[model samples]
Target: MQNKNHELHVICVNLLATLWDYNRVGKDAEDGDIEEIISMASKSDLADQEKQVQENIHSQITNFCTFMDQILLPESKSHETTSQKHSTAPRPSGLSLAIGRNAPPDTKFEIPETKPLTFAESCQRIKDLMGYTLELKPSQIPHEQAGQGLFVDGEADVGSVIALYPGVIYSPAYYRYIPGYPRVDSQNPYLITRYDGTVINGQPWGTGGETREPWAHSNVYRPNPSEPPSETGSDRVWKMLSKPLEGSRLGFNGEVLERRNPLALGHFANHPAMVMEPNVMVCPYDFPLNEKGMRAYIPNVVFGGVEEVKMKRFGSFWFKSRGESNDGQMTGPVMKSLALVATRLICNEEVYLNYRLSNSKRRPSWYTPVDEDEDRRRWS
Candidate 1:
């Protein structure tokens, strides 16, 4: 139940984060101002009536989580999720190159002598905390290219945070520097975008994790020099754009983060089939960097590095399935990442998420729109 409430708080955090941007349409904002515009609606500065509105939003999210719990609790008992046989052995930890193989010049963040948390250890902690475990193996999605999939190895109740999407986070300001800019989706399909335009590339934090050492994230997605160049308008725009400098002045060496969170394989979950309803939904989570106790579990690193930005201004609503700016384009102190939350009781079965691929782009043959209206709203 504690885990459920934490998940509920995250959902509301996102819904309210966009409240500040709901109004006040104007010209583009400067670096600092751009970050502020997406922040949480200020409570201290609000008028009495506005304060009441803020309070009202809090109540609604709480009530919604409670309502869903009431409805899903009974259904959980009748149907168990055993569609395919799971690999009973613990999955392998994500591969990691030996420490110091490619050490950066900036020695600010040191290489610790102690080994970081292991995949099996992280999985044990999650099960102890949430009463469920997860698995990853060949997916049985009936497609020729089902690749890999995330599975709930134990019973998971509704509103539980099932998996976390890990890797370096790119804020709106840093879009130009993404491994493949104008065509950010060019080579990798693990990228997910927040409504505020923050993008997280999950390709770096693949499968599960083995270490908390500074895993180089942004370094993994560099454009392949050998690939044939294309004449597409997207390619031309990117090639013509002046490249912005990377790295952080705020003391961060750049996109190296702890890739040791075992549940960070949220990227492995596949889009649901045409006949299936998604069992899990994407929820935006703002991991507070200062919280030492829970810090290790939150595995993400800021890209360019951001200046001071208020944390409250950039949280989510309780219902979200979905951040800010800077001079060189960096994220706020809060590392924003996506997490998959179970919408229904799940047993030993594959987790399905609505990919919500944009209609503006060409989609795969197996792809079907989960909600046409949602795709329009997102890409438009």
Candidate 2:
């Protein structure tokens, strides 16, 4: 009975987390208006249309709640004479999990001390190593009268601090890996690079994206700051290049599986400056989720940093694209939401794991799907 209860709790948490992830991306303020307008367009009467849509949405919610109630109920029956059957359980729909908020903050905020490095030195180091600039965003630089113009107290190395938080301090590294000839290899380059982020041979690997495989000779170690530059480097070069780079021409090739319009109506009503931009790169391959049929396509937190950009893109009066490719042909929306979702999901998982480890819980169940084994079995 206890084991079944524990399973129920686990399943509920996983389902809730999955739904939350979808709502974060799919549910926009504009959805209500869109639904209303669509209903009005379809029906002659405004009140009747509104009521119909409301009823439809309500039915969907009620069905979900009923499913949850059934799943969470214990299966075992008590034989005691005085025992009574379980009463109807009131199911919670779309309840937010605020469990970790009350936990006391961890005190292990002690960052390591290193040799002093100036801003210029840091910029030079990144340029020399990765052939790119490390210009700090305005927010990252220390302001006058703010802690004596230092980013933090007792921080001697500016370079190290910036590197420690590159995503926050500077724009993240964005490179365009042009799909190579014979198409499939170039399009699916990322698949070769990312890891599943599982530990093997006592080493950690597999989180998906840019960490999967290696260059033929240098496949042993993932690229890191300490590693030397590859002589036979990938054609996926830095965005900032000296010459007219080979992969500069933007390409769009992929299929759109799903889409959600942004909420704000007047976002791009008369904005003439908005143009349909080409994709940064073209992949000749489909995302893994397409093959696996996973509804939990990508996690939200992975690409949370780009939340502002994504929101603006969706909210603005413009048509965003989703795409897929086959037979070396790219089709569908010019841009892929899956890529964005993938990035966010990956980042979110990393953040969750890091936070859990910092909080003294070595294993954060958030990243590990509770029903993963069951899912595999069912699929198989």
Candidate 3:
């Protein structure tokens, strides 16, 4: 139940994050603003909201678990006593019984070398043939304990298609090996080589790969971790477009891109201009401030980091399944939902909210007494 709620909160945040990216329009923002918005919406500010959502989700999940427990209480109690023994009938397998992998051959699948067929094409061919042969979709194997026999309907040629393919199978890891790939770890659900030259469960013979690759994660997609920052095209754009909001003295000078001379990792970590501030890991509601106070200040602090922008953007899409189930499955939608919800309560009423101050019908911001306790500040 706890796990279920955590999953729900993650799904909710993913939904909001997806919405944020999808809603982006107007002219391209200055890099700093883009980074700031991305970071705040996806990572920094939402961290607090995610925490609160997780708590709520957990509470709901606990209630659900409790309800389920109550419903099954009579059956459980009866199982312990001889007077009212529950009938011990065979349990019905949900979906797994239809298609499964049981005692599959020591299968050696060799690739036909003319050209490598993609994993999808191979799977599709198998599906097309299944019309004549007796077999079920791979997903059903989970509910059926019958194992690999699920692929066979009293005797059908399942191995014929699998044998024509290369040892390489598509799983999360194999995606990296594809041309123009990003930060995929080598060890993964797919195997580069078939272990022991045989197939098991109609997938592969080998043990699962060693990589800690999270599916649909942005960190693993753009800005491949193995590549240097200088070589990254996206990083170049991130740097060039980064600047102060478009009307202040700093904004006009393009000084936000100015790097400090002496710092080794550029000026961000060590420069006098880049002050070191504590980063709170929790989400908005979990933090000390109320929603209005948090909304007003968090946007500024969250958008502060240029590098963090991509992570926030990527995280929005990282966790999702495709098609009808795709709704709110990604982080983008999740952040957008939060932003939309907060917008009503915290009015950012400046006419120039989306524009540079010089271009807007608005008064210049004045330096006033800062709400020291309410605002959260951080340095990149």
Best by lDDT: 1
Tens-digit lDDT track for model 3 on 13-54? 654443334335323546676566556656644566555454
The window of 10 residues in a row where model 2 has the poorest summed lDDT is 161-170
Could you tell me which 10 consecutive residues in candidate 3 have the lowest summed lDDT?
258-267
Error of 2 at 18 (Å): 29
Compared with the true structure, what per-residue lDDT tens digits does model 1 show for residues 78-161?
132111101221212111111222334454443323334466765665565556677788887888767888888888765556
Worst 10 residues of 1 by lDDT: 313-322
- Which segments of model 3 are wrong by more than 4 Å? 1-44, 75-171, 174-380
User: Per-prediction RMSD in angstroms?
Assistant: 15.3, 27.2, 26.8
Clashes of each: 17, 26, 42
Candidate 1 lDDT score at position 140:
73
lDDT per residue as tens, model 2, 164-271 = 110000011112121121132332212221111111110111111211111011122112334344433232233123123232221111111101101001011110
lDDT of 2 at 205: 16
